[model samples]
Target: MLYFKHYAGALLLLVMVTGLISCRQEEPPLQKVLEVRNLSDLATTEYHITKIVKASDDKTWYKLGDRKILMSVEAVLKAGIDLSKLQPEDVIIDGKNITLNLPAPKLISLNLPPSGIKVEYQEIGALRDPFDNAARDALLAQAEKQIRRDIAATGIFTETENNTRTLITGFLQHAGYNNITIRFSPQTPLP
Candidate 1:
């Protein structure tokens, strides 16, 4: 009786092992729909730019001498497309050949950290008062504005667009797309 019980137990364990071995995990289905919220503001490129801000208080007719301040400011610029702006009609997939009308690349953010701005040189006239915080801030603001205008000259926008295209193209290719054409759609600023 003992010998029969042992052989039955061994047989049961072998059957359980075979059943477990034959079971396979099912893979999740590939997602076809793109979620815009998940792809919002995908910053593809960043640039660190330094600008020299110099301003002279020479416009005053009664001021005795010119008071000049020179400052060095570093600005961080991030650029990318807002994929959340993508519309259903923007993407057209015809049997693995996909065409996407993506949002145009835009300047995502420009940050000038307070620590990155320094007053390098200042020439205060003997009769003139020193540069105050408000004056310094105004100079920095003007510099920031100029930097924003000059960002396009740095080629950051073009590089950001190219990087975004390469990333999306690779993603689509991996999703089984053979041919991909991407076009940038013009976006109007929201008031």
Candidate 2:
């Protein structure tokens, strides 16, 4: 009788422990979604592009003669998704499978360092004065604008979106998710 009582107590204790463990609350999937949203900007692709800055004073009547300047400038373009746009509805969890709907990637930054600009060629007619600092600054500004306008044609946005998916997929897999599906919200118009 003593042996049976001891075994019964052990069995009861084991059952209680198992029940507590099974009943323990698992973190809701929405919590994980918020965690991802906190990641903010996720820059996935960068492009080092060189642009030509050319200007001529021949068109201006105030100029005595033709004055031209040509310059080369390198720009850094970065594109990525802004995770802060993620909503709870964007994340769908089914058992081990998870589907994350993310906003489409956009231009994160465009850097045109002064050090990246170089004078390639200059021509000042004998009757014309050399290009001033203001002229050079204006030329650089025009070049920057052109680069921004041409970004969409370079296909960087598409590449950025692909890289973002690959990155988030690996991250979710590491978080113990088995089947992962990453979908992007409709892309916003490009600048």
Candidate 3:
């Protein structure tokens, strides 16, 4: 009986040691390399239009060719994951003729500010019907008020001038604004 007990213990120890040794974790596989011959050749590749803002209208009130044309536009483009397979430095543009070159692309991702404030602006452009300086100021004030109210409704951030600016700056940064400076006073009184 004593000899059998000692052998059983030895066998259990041997099995555990062998099991641990054989159960090594495997390493992850490396990413595959993409083969891109010509970026222009891939002009037909679909691109996602993230945002578009128009700021222009036809202006022809005076004589022939005397009228002016205003233009305001902002657009964001994403090539999608298929383009990710290509080299990051490569550039692709489509028009009458496809243009391809190496251009550094700017990538930006923005998070909503903790304050729950939302802000947006239209692209600049000359307009026939323009707002007066005072009207523009009033518009800005209204916008600020709306932002404060929206944020307050969410109850996410304390109402303070510094916090508002911080939240706005953070949101802009997340939205891919490389150089962003938000300037505004707090609309809501601090709790």
> Best by lDDT, which number?
2
Span of 10 residues, lowest total lDDT, candidate 3: 72-81
Residues 62-162, model 3: lDDT tens digits:
52322122222222222111233345333222222222222222112122222332224433234345434454445445444443344334333222333
Better of 1 and 3 by lDDT: 1
Higher-ranked by lDDT: 1 or 2: 2
For candidate 2, what is the lDDT?
A: 0.89
Ranking of predictions according to TM-score = 2, 1, 3
Please give, for residues 1-191, the per-residue lDDT of candidate 1 as tens digits.
99999999999999998888778653322235366437899999999999999989878999998799999999999999988877777888787788888887898899999989998999988899999999888988998889877777888877988999999998888878999998986644422
Could you tell me the TM-score of candidate 3?
0.18
Models 1 onward score TM values of 0.77, 0.84, 0.18
Every candidate's lDDT: 0.84, 0.89, 0.34
lDDT of 2 by residue, 1-191 (tens): 99999999999999999999889987886686569778899999999999998887788887678888899999999999999999888888998999999998889999998889999999899898898998888888898899988888888988998999999999888888999999887766665
Clashing pairs in 3: 55-72, 109-174, 110-174, 110-175
The Cα RMSD of model 2 versus the native structure comes to 4.0
Specify the highest-TM-score model's number: 2
